[model samples]
Target: MISIVLIGTGNVARHLFDTFRLYDKINIVQVVGRNEQALAYFGQYSKTGSNFSNTEPADIYIIAVSDDAIAPVSQLIANVKGVVAHTSGSVPMEALSKHPHKGVIYPLQTFSKERKIDLKNVPLCLESDQKKDLEVLNRLAHLISDHVYGISSKQRKSLHLAAVFVNNFTNHLYQIGKELCEENNLPFEILNPLILETAQKLETLSPCEAQTGPAKRGDLSTLKKQVGQLKNDRLIKIYELFSRSIQMKFSRD
Candidate 1:
């Protein structure tokens, strides 16, 4: 059995703990965090503690803390015999330099404390300094996910940048779309089907091939009208910038 100790009680940590508990092959030895209140969520499943000095021996110590705190937290457990792995896409593996065995297990999916996701579908990116540590991470990753890739720190950073554009920026645009619909007295639900279909198209066609809109077609008349309708200066500027970028991209094609 692969014994694991998860550090941190945020969304990613909570989500991972929930998924790990379902697998009989894996054991959640303990969960540690500075916040006693947040650590309560893991109390029902594993031994919970706030002090780093009290951490028990485990096969792997997974640090799921914030990007900035990863280095400091890893330093605390530098003496442990277990393989030290972090769940960060952007942070470099060298951040765990204090540990003899360092690795990364980054899940390429957005996590929310309120929303539960299927771990089997989530892409797990694994990296390790040694072959033995890589094998250990591969075993753990394959147990929870069907899709696992050996991604290096450089490649993981690039993937993280793309993810921000696809997930974070796109969600911000959706929020803007919702506000525009509400201001125009149109039901925000009207855009739900369109949004779903746009995402669905990516399953068969690449985003570049699935692209269709006034900007892609260079419909200056429609673009002008759309920009003119937006009363907010910020929205107008955003529309112009995005339209210009789309036009430039397709024009080269």
Candidate 2:
């Protein structure tokens, strides 16, 4: 059995804790965090504490804290003998230098406390300083996820950057679309089918191939009309920028 000490109370920690508990081979030794109220959520399933100094010994110590707090939080468990890993896409494995065995187990999926996701579908990115620790992480990752990848720190940083573009930026665009619909007295739900189809198309078509609209077709008249329709200067600027970017991409092709 692989014992784990999860250190955080945030969305990622909660999701992981909920998923790990379901597997019989995984034993959650304890959960550590700074907030007592947040720690209470894990109290029902395992030992929960606010003090890092009293962390329990486990086969793996998974630090699911924020990126900035990773290093300092890791220092608290410097004396422990376990494979210490962090669930960060951008942060490098060196942040856990205080530990003899360091690794990374980044789940490439947005986590929400209220939203339930299938762990088996979520991509798990694994990295480690030691070969043995990598094997251990791989074993643990495979238990919950079918999509596991061994990613380097440099490669992981690049993936995180692309994720921001695909997830964060795309979501912001959705917000803009919703606002436009609301301003015109249209239901935002009207765009749901379009959004779903766009995502589903990615399975078979490359982004460039799936591309459509005035920008892709270079219909200057339609572009002008759309730009003229937007009253908000910020939204207009964003629209024009994206249109220009798309035009330039295909122009080069």
Candidate 3:
């Protein structure tokens, strides 16, 4: 059995703890954090504490803390014999170099405590300083996920940048759409089907192939009307920037 001591009690930590508990081969030795209130959630199922100085020896110590706190937290457990891994995509593996065995187990998905995500489809990016430690991380990743990739720190950094464009930036666009709908007294729900279809097209078609709209077709008249209708300068600039980018990408001649 693979025993894991999960550090931190944030969204990622909670989700991982819930998923690990369902697997019989995995044992959650402890969930440690500085916040007593946050530890209560994990305390219901396993041993929980705020102190990191005293911790039981486990097969792996997973740090699910913020990117800035990763290095300092790893320092606390540097003496442990178990493999030390952080769940961060952008942070380098050398952050945990203080430990003999260091690795990364980054899950490429947005985590929310209220929203439960299925690990089966989420990609798990694994990396390690040692070859044997990589195998250990791979074994652990396969327990809850099927899509596991041996990704390096450099590769993971690029993947994270792309994710920001795809997930974070796209979500911001959705928010802008919602605001536009509200300004015109239209229900945002009216765009739900269109949004769903846009995402569905990506399953069978490449993003470039699935592209549509006035910008793609170079409909300057419609684009001008969109810009003229926007009351906010910020929204107008955003629309103009995106439209220019689309035109540049899909210019015919």
Measured by TM-score, the strongest candidate is: 2
Q: Order of candidates by TM-score, top first?
A: 2, 1, 3
- Candidate 1 stretches with Cα past 4 Å from truth are none
lDDT value, residue 80 of candidate 3: 91
Expressed as tens digits, the lDDT of each residue in 141-186 for candidate 2 is 9999999999999999999999999999999999999999999999
Name the regions of candidate 3 deviating beyond 4 angstroms. Answer: none
TM-scores for all candidates?
0.97, 0.98, 0.97
| Candidate 2 backbone collisions, by pair | none
Kindly list the per-residue Cα lDDT of model 3 for residues 1-253, writing each as its tens digit.
9999999999999999989989999999999999998888886755689779888899999999999999999998878999999999899999998998999999999998779999988999999979999989999999899999999999999999999998999899999989989989999999999988988999999999998899999999999998998989999999999999999998853
lDDT per residue as tens, model 1, 1-253: 9999999999999989999999999999999999998988887855688879778999999999999999999988878899999999999999999898999999999998779999999999999979999999999999999999999999999999999999999999999999999998999999999999999999999989998999999999999999889999989989999999999999999
True lDDT of residue 151, candidate 3: 94
Candidate 2 wrong stretches, greater than 4 Å: none
Select the stronger candidate by TM-score from 2 and 3. Answer: 2
